[model samples]
Target: MKTLLHAAGLAAWLAMSQASAGISLNGTRVIFDGAHPEASVTVRNHGADILVQSWLEALDSDKAELPFAITPPLTRLPAGQEQLLRILYAGAGASDQQETAFWLNVQEIPQAAGKGNVLQLAVRQRVKVFYRPPGLDGDALQAPERLRWRLRRERGNSWLQADNPSRYHVTVTGLTLLSGGKSKEISRAQMLAPGAGGQWPLPADTANDARLRYQIINDFGASQAFEARLQGVAPAQPQRLEP
Candidate 1:
């Protein structure tokens, strides 16, 4: 078991690092190949000697029990030193046609402060681990562009509908609607599972002939942009944006 420890949001890394006591992770996210026996991640300590802990948790409590195990969950990491964390999955019958995600947690437990009134904070880094079954259809990296999009109106409110027909999961980072020289940003951080769909609210005054520009989180943990023209699109039908 081995790969990157993918953080859910990069901003979280910045917020936590301000404390000046933390560990550095090697990757933005983890991709666990189903056919492989294990995945690995590199964890490095930047401060004084401390005890580090690593574990995995199910993304959804309603889902099946996590069949993954992380070795050496507890270890002592010296200052300026790093260790390789290994992950082993039991292949818990995850969907053969789609990818499943989990939370990979690595926490820092610093040695007790010697002085009185000293505060010791244990900072933990949480990232996503995508378990991709072997031989799935389509390209995972291109799934975001392949999504079907449409703008809909309901009860005086406009909504943007996104339908992902691909076999991989896609995480959206940003969405903006541009029409008639007006641009409106929509707040939505979401992950679309294969063949699943979601909707986001749009400005009530959105133009009929609008242009939609959005960004999706790529495998490398960066935002990739896509643009689409939304004019004369039927409310009930999904359409792919112009290439």
Candidate 2:
């Protein structure tokens, strides 16, 4: 029989929450201003002594790269103490046209093993990091309200395409698609940046009379709901069989 610390068991434990939580990040999101080449994030250990590992991942990449560097990538943070991790961008993948985003993951691992039948799990926390380029256009706070939405059909599937024309990122949550007296909601949160767009799969019939309602995550991480109907979008027509 495999113990709870086995590979599979550990994987399951990683997915669950531990009672003795210790690590916390300063901000829900990190912004890397273009004018500066470095940014810092503060990590606080509120419970027991633990080792925290930090890394950065591109939005669509599976692995973390070195365009950015974290000071003391792995460090032991004592209880009630805090560590400031500096992030340096070498301009490796920087784009002058629009803003780019990445994910910052901080994992906390306990340092001591208690003598008992106690289960301890490592806690991993992830946050978004936005790299803003100079002279992109518009204010970050107004970006969400400037977003444009459309309902489209491709390859027999219906989708909602959200376009962000500003230089700032607009995080959307609680999105719902309403049509034909029926309503469906998005399962996860989405974020769109300047000149960037994302497609959310929707019901085929919903394309005909689709209206989208969602909340935008502001610079402070607060959600504000808004509703709008897709504009300049044509509904998909069902194929007809020839007799």
Candidate 3:
């Protein structure tokens, strides 16, 4: 446990120093290997002594319970110090159909010093945690690029479907439809795992042959753009990739 803790701190410190100023995470995302008992995350405290709290919550509460726990849920993080946190999956069982996505919330609480109406706000950081079962096929890094986009209709209702065929999770950060020289951005933020899919209701007047341009959240917590056309139409080629 101690070694795991040490490793967690190192990872957090390396990943978050410049981008996150006061507190940084070791990695952009947490991948929990189901064959193992737990995963590790490091939190580095670059500011003054503060209290840090963390927890895990499931995205689809209706499907399964949030079965993960973060050790040392709340602790005093001394200035210039770092600590490794453990995420243990204690749920009934891992999802067999697809990778389960959860949210890891880490909040930093700073003391309030009354100095002329000072505002001492607590800064909370949230990151995606993907629970991957053993024996899942395909590479996670390629999952985003492998996603299939299509326009579907059922009972006179049209919707945009994004199917994930890879054995990894794809986090869609932004989506838009293009048709008749008109572009409409769809508001959606969800992760689709291997063998799973997501559908967004399209506007009643949306073009049936509209193309889709979406952004996937990469491992670094950054968005990467990609384009695809409806299933029956010719594929929409990508323009330029975001660096």
Candidate 4:
């Protein structure tokens, strides 16, 4: 499966927790249907009373105003149960391949009882909509024009580094096992720009038998696959065992 790498600035706010009594949005993800995009908003209640609120704003990728807002007639979310708010873009005139941002602003509501309201709050979330064209297939990769990798061992720790000095983005998608067999994918990522490099931390228990195989995918629907062997030994302990 493919996942979009979130821009650096937006990652911080998306990781916040909203389990408190005040209004908050959590577990937000964008789903694109090629023609229309849907933003699912979940509002959690951590207090004793129900939540009644109104419209929220949605923005585009450039931080511009989207012509849509999320205003359900009656948003009554009971304590602990989440309310799923769906915002559709069917009527909104937009392109399929273009990327846009959807921002949400949650309004606050006053408490029903005579006591002062403590549930007044506002939260924002963003979603990117992109179109996925058809006729794409997955296949094994060929070697790239240039390939370089390194393995370094330290005190009970090792590092694996890979570099792609070519002019295309590379995808590493597979892993090889240590016991003369292949294993399922452990991790995958795209390497951007020429001269870009990445480092992977190796576990202390992994000895000379461990190995990793990776594939490099380019933007033009081509890929390169290779393997890297890792040799490790346990860090020497100062004391010897008594027999």
Candidate 5:
């Protein structure tokens, strides 16, 4: 009954192997914009039990471990079902060109099992950052004057006037809107001489709740910019003048 015992032992080993199962991760990739980056992975479970826990890993070209590894939230996958997991890389700084090599490590904890299994998946992606440079005009170039905007009259269309003195060949560059808790680029122009500094006609439906920033650029790549608040004020009603 030595033969019978040996056969029984082999059957038990096969049964144990079949019982311990895991999920497979496929089609892993990292996506990066100039400002933000994200990772996506596809998980497929082929075992008879559910998978409850999972993790990921990222590596460089030399197989060195990355300082930042994303662990997706714990989830359960029914047997033979698949799901997609996503992770975001929230880093700072603006580098135009940086190569980020990465990969995925998917771990699955099977239900009613004491130990979990891990699967290794691979991925690679590059990062790109972008920015704009300030522009300049001819010799009459000087640092752009700081703009202090004031409201003259409130009417149908809002009007804004800057207390700036016009200088020849000195144009404004890098005029931007840093309002609504966000930054946005604006157009540039050369101010004509002999008049009130510069006037920006506020558009109808314009919310006077943003800070304006502007810069003066010279021919030599030199620039200066400043910020000013666009304080909210009550609109004035049109007054009828006696003839």
Candidate 6:
């Protein structure tokens, strides 16, 4: 029986996550600094003959202020081949106070096979593109440590509130709240916007004083762990874990 997978799989992938993709990016994410003329990333194809189309997309609701230009937007990628995607910055119009975030979408176009019942599929991958402007206020690495946390209870619901006061985006990858004897694990990656505070609902919270262990993804996309004592007002900042 002939099977169809191109549209349905692509739609499901867009709504959710996929186990794997036909093409892989060399880096986890891309960082385009304002001081540099451009940035590039390596895209390698698996054992599939497909067309790779890459383009920059705006993450914000307003799309009038884009400042990036991608080269080789559409190219034919053979089996087990690789190519370099160059991202040239316009060098203007981005905010100088805070880092801007964008989405780089790499989509795979499936080629037809000369068979009777072939399962054709197309895959897509998205990576965060962080554009750090020149003369930013704070360092990207130190932005995680500057965060403060406190347990907020409102309307019979307990939430872990995280306050970020830095100019760079801080992505929280792992979190665990430990009480006297019980521990609740929160395993989700959430990006805290610059100069903003966010709250995540807690499964349970009954400790008088708890230890908050949180992990953040750094500039290179590596997870680093940190811990702090949860307070009524978050007096103590997060301390980095010692290697």
State TM-scores per candidate. 0.85, 0.78, 0.73, 0.36, 0.33, 0.85
| Backbone clash tally (model 1) | 10
**Model 2, residue 71: what's the lDDT?**
79
In candidate 4, clashing pairs total 4
Model 6, residue 159: what's the lDDT? 80
Cα lDDT for residue 242, candidate 3:
59
- Give per-residue CA lDDT, model 2, range 1-243, as digits (tens): 567458878766655545458988988989888888788899999887899999888887775563777777999998999999988888776777777788899999887686877667778999988888867767786777777777877788877877877877888888887776778989788878678878888777674656677777766666777777664384322121122
Q: Return whichever of 1 and 3 wins on lDDT.
A: 1
* Candidate 5 global TM-score: 0.33
lDDT of 1 by residue, 1-243 (tens): 122334444446656655577598998899988889888899998888999999988888677668788988999999999989998977665778888889899999989888788546788998999988888888887787778778888788988888888888888757888888988888778888889988888777877887777778888887777777776344332233443
User: What are the RMSDs of all candidates, in order?
Assistant: 8.6, 8.1, 10.7, 15.4, 22.0, 4.9
**Which pairs clash in model 4?**
59-103, 61-101, 142-224, 171-217
Per-residue lDDT of 226 in model 5 = 57
Which candidate, 3 or 5, has the higher TM-score?
3
Q: What lDDT is reached at residue 5 by model 3?
A: 100
TM-score of decoy 2: 0.78
Q: What would the per-residue lDDT of candidate 3 be over residues 1-243, giving only the tens digit for each residue?
A: 999999998777656543444677898888888888889999999888888988877765566567678998998999999989999987567675558788898888776675686535577888889888877777677778777776767777777777777878878867878887998888877778677888888876677676677788877777888877664423333443555
Candidate 5 ranges with C-alpha deviation above 4 Å: 1-20, 28-37, 58-71, 93-96, 113-243
Best by lDDT: 6
Candidate 6 structure quality by residue, lDDT tens digits, 93-163: 78888988998989888788785975566788899999988778778889999998888777767888888
| Candidates, ranked, lDDT | 6, 1, 2, 3, 5, 4
Task: List runs of model 6 lying over 4 Å from the truth.
Answer: 1-21, 60-65, 203-205
Please report how far candidate 1 places residue 165 from its true position, in Å. 0.6
**How many Å off is the CA of 211 in candidate 1?**
0.7
**Candidate 6: what lDDT?**
0.83
